[model samples]
Target: MAIELETETADGDDFVVYNHVAPPLSELDMQVIKSVPPGGNWADIPLSIAQKSKRIMQIRKSGGRTTYYGRLRNDLPSYTVSTYFYRPGNGSFVHPEQDRMISVREAARLQSFFDEHRFLGPASSQYKQVGNAVPPLLGRAVGVTIPSGFAVDLFCGAGGLSHGLR
Candidate 1:
């Protein structure tokens, strides 16, 4: 069977989509996904114990911040950032690893957002947007099933699946 799908980009660009059938995730991928916490990154764990870590360089110093280079909300300084241990239940303001919450860019990368994707607004706003976005990789996995039959996306937000479908 074949199916046609429509996707729209954040900028409102439209495209048609199709896909081929593929097997479900293997045991290893499932295990990895299961092991990883939601919105968590390697930095969530202690540096001495973490398997991976990422550093985010801010565009401007926090004291004299410019809109173009500050952290997503301009409230925090640029420094080492990771989502290795972030969890919604742990509270909104606590850092998943260090004493500060993860930055917007850090959250975005964990959610599979490409570095090239420019986010709009302040640091906190960006973090909220990135945190709320669906992981693009997961959306791509779902898109792989489009060619086999009709696909429905429940709780679609910002159309990540639609982007993947294309």
Candidate 2:
């Protein structure tokens, strides 16, 4: 079930494709995405503009602190993927350059899932599954102690551990 992806690289188009698909962004989502600058978040927006949202207004009025409505820098690792990643206010889920939320495939890659690892269910469900996953690198490190040829994953969701075990 591996899908080939054609990505343009410095050399040329990379022919490696990933099986993962991302959920599409809505028009409002696109609008919200365009409002963010690279490595910026809703916090960077003018107070007048952000105040339209009750959530932002309440947070500001309460004098509470939050890293929500932020963006990830291209040079840095992503914030912990949360189940609510569909909302930009939940975390820095926006693409560094693209004006949209990070795709399911991107999230999977961040979690160290192989390109061939496929997720089941709807897009939102896929995001939740990926967000709740243990990083494959950590899984590999933990798997090193298991007896050769015998491995078990107690809470495998998207096969991060099982993939690493292989």
Candidate 3:
């Protein structure tokens, strides 16, 4: 599996997608992603169909993790975006509509990262940056409670609180 960026005018959203790229994926990876439905996971794939995959077959034998090969649910909140989001086998990373992993920008959006906060690195590093981020939205939520005081930020995780408080 790999992370590939695709750009489109985000409909009814504040973000514009661009700087698209790909990490490259094998045919098997694409097939597995295509097999999942919105809100579906590895269990949705029949054993007969996924048999060609050693990992998938092993998952079947061991009983699957809910996060494994999961697709996003359009109507629901997203699951946590971990560093493993780049791979379909690792988390609920598949796009709700497209038969591919969610792009870096999309994952950033999930983390409430603004469009201007560009990630500068290889595709894997970009994915890592987005996945490990502490969302500005969450920080903003915390900031809301402080009312007014000497805000002392002790733990800095990408200046999320500072961004939100700004």
Query: Which pairs of residues collide in candidate 3?
Result: none
Q: Which residue runs of candidate 1 sit more than 4 Å off their true CA positions?
A: 1-97, 148-166
Q: Candidate 1's error at 134, in angstroms?
A: 0.6
Better of 1 and 2 by lDDT: 2
RMSD of 1: 20.2
Task: Please provide, for model 3 over 46-110, each residue's C-alpha lDDT reduced to its tens digit, 9 standing for 90 to 100.
Answer: 76669989999999889889879999988999999998787889989888987777777788888
How high is the CA lDDT of each candidate model? 0.40, 0.70, 0.79
Candidate number with the higher TM-score (1 or 3): 3
As for lDDT, the candidate ahead, 1 or 3, is 3
Least lDDT summed over 10 consecutive residues: which range in candidate 2?
1-10
Task: Compose the digit string of candidate 1's lDDT tens values, residues 72-145.
Answer: 22344433233322332123323323323344445555567765576776544555566566778879987896
Could you tell me which 10 consecutive residues in candidate 1 have the lowest summed lDDT?
53-62
Q: Determine the C-alpha RMSD for candidate 3 after optimal superposition of all C-alphas.
A: 6.8
lDDT for residue 96 in candidate 2, whole number 0-100: 79
Q: Candidate 1 vs candidate 2: which has greater TM-score? A: 2
Off by over 4 Å in 2: 1-29, 63-66, 145-166
| lDDT per residue (tens digit) for residues 43-136 in model 2 | 5656656656787667667754445666668888788887776677677887777666667777888889876687878777887888999989
